[model samples]
Target: MASFPKSPFPKPPFDRQKPQDPPGRDADMDPRPDYGEASYKGSGRLADRKAIITGGDSGIGKAVALAFAREGADVLVSYYDEHEDARETCRLVEEAGRQAIAMPGDIKDPTHCRALAERAAEAFGRIDILVNNAAHQKTFESLEEISDAEWEVTFATNIHAMFYLTKAALPHMRAGASIINTTSVNADTPSPQLLAYATTKGAIQNFTGGLAQILAERDIRVNCVAPGPIWTPLIPSTMPMEKVKNFGAQVPMKRPGQPCELAPVYVMLASPESSYVSGATVAVTGGKPFI
Candidate 1:
């Protein structure tokens, strides 16, 4: 019998230093993430397009901003309060030889979300892509530990904000526009400790599909990307320190993914390269099964 082909991927240099934040810290993370600003060559995949990305200040959002800039799009990064992170992301975008604007505000409010869309449009003269990637999650020991405030805030940040921002952006978007939402692997995996947060993520998946069909006639595509455990500031900022150390080990790959590795999917989904793809969820989880 012929032996199965050997896997080609080499062992990743996994660093085991304890991440400082509950969600994780991009600045102090061992083996800093790949930004691809200098190396990723673009054939103008998103040239002349303008993009607005929520939570673009740090983590996966920051990675996507830099990638989009490299792909020839002017990027508007909407962030909450991480000024330093936002500035760093802006610098990377500028380094890509594209324009980047860091707009700081709370996305949970409809007015702020609308303003972001409008301002991005004004600054770039058009809005072609929207990436709803900002999210907040807190660990709970049990279901009862999830308070009403937590539930509301989670939905506000994760789901409601997406709805509000997309609605505001639609008018400015012409045919061939794209909207990308950031869901999570926990949506399908359903962690008991993250019941509320996972619920919002699952809603985002269904929301993406339903909205895609509604916007199909207008030629605006909607989709979601569900990432597995990634080394981002959110891990150190939200999870227990010890759990943060072993965050991605549960995946089949036995290591967490980096934000840079997952950034291309955003570009693919946003660019004309994925013209026929919509109502889809691009799974970037390391070896995790997608349902």
Candidate 2:
């Protein structure tokens, strides 16, 4: 008999964890998230490619960086101030016998977003894949709890930064280059508690659709991945203890996804194998359908 993917992941209710700020450290989590360190083996799918992955310090971004490296790509890991996490990501990439650079900065700032692109081009000579995977998310009960400043920051970090980074990377990206954005299941099924974050995710899907058409003549592919509940540092740090305990129970799989599980999809998107796939949002929703 074949085993299911969800059989390996831990299920809810998880250990009750206190909520901290966003971009939490994976080291602090009770059950450390997996980034395919033991399981994934690349087959030169992205050989000699040069790529940039934002939020590469932890979560999905880290997994993507590690996978890209194993697939023969040199990666520039762009991240926020998570120096420790960022260093670990670079180490993983280098351990795979690839060049890795950790560039820490605030992606919410347009200037930093531009600088990130410039740094990737400087280190790699050309940009073959651009993964806009860095994001900011906060949960709120109602509109009243969502402050004006918080709302603006969410949009700035989530959507605006993607625009800034993509625009900066365009010149360096040639005809076969790929651009992958990280959207969410919330883009279709808005989580009541994650109002602002969900709204921006919706915007990302629309942006990707329009931009894909705009860049089609250039032959640059643009797409996104909409992941459901995934066990990442951001979860324990952003959600309340009650919510954290029951984090991914709602999904049909009844468990939060491990970052490693989503890495293959990202790997495919960044590879030339996905040349015909653009303007599409691939949903990794743990059995929860999104259309």
Candidate 3:
């Protein structure tokens, strides 16, 4: 087992780095967010399962993908334009003796989402798990700072794509399959600076709750993971430098969560053990109450 610090970060106040475009590169991150490359050990919980994970390029998505691969699941890593990060995720999956397919495109587009579903069906023969883990976020200090286009794109990338991809993937999903979405603490406690992103996260929680019931009759489980401040590429790319420096200080742990810390919960949600669990939001908030 790999030992971790109290904060899961190298230091309390992380060193400031250059501003990156949306969905920053993990390689360029100062601390290089851990994705359980060395610590994670699997026990065939998801043996032979087929899974599709959006945003599998880095952070939570990458960590989940690694855990799934280690558990003997074939993974299809769907990502945006982050080829380098996506490639590394695929390499990890392959290293675990599982099939890995790197498919890159914009999930904001409905057509691309359908294509992702079709490709997964073609490659994996069927879809056993769909992880709607990709999202786009850019912080705005005030309501006025958020433009009309910005508002629309956040919804498109965060919530709308989840709908489209879930719809497209359902046809291939069988009973006992799982759909795990990545919501956030922002869904419960909206962040004023991330108004648009928070709004979409709320929508996602609603969507997850409703869909869980709708699919329950079919025996298909639906759930979401609500993470607190996590040390992911999304932070530095979207939030201001000051906020980035003090990231996760608000939580009781007074530190951001590492991506690897979230893998076990995802593994439980995807495996057969969660057969009776649906419409549940598992909060990985580093000791912070999710409500």
Q: Which candidate is the best by lDDT?
A: 3
What lDDT does model 3 reach?
0.93
Stretches of model 2 off by over 4 angstroms after superposition: 1-6
User: Candidates' lDDT values, in order?
Assistant: 0.85, 0.93, 0.93
**Candidate 1 local distance difference test against the native:** 0.85
* Angstrom error at residue 222, model 3: 0.3
Task: Return the clash pairs for model 3, or none.
Answer: none
Rank by lDDT, descending? 3, 2, 1
User: What is the alpha-carbon lDDT of model 2 when measured against the actual structure?
Assistant: 0.93
What's the best-to-worst order under TM-score? 2, 3, 1
What value does the lDDT take at residue 138 in candidate 3?
90
TM-score of each: 0.91, 0.97, 0.97
Better of 2 and 3 by lDDT: 3
Which consecutive 10 residues in model 3 have the weakest lDDT in total?
4-13
Alpha-carbon shift of residue 137 in model 2 (angstroms): 0.9
**Cα RMSD (Å) per model?**
2.9, 1.4, 2.5
lDDT per residue (tens digit) for residues 1-291 in model 3: 999655435545998977898799898788889899999999999999999999999989999999999999999999989999999999999999999999999999999999999999999899999999999999888889889999999999999999999999999999999999999999999989889999999999999999999999999999999999999999999888998998988888888899999999999999999899899999999799988
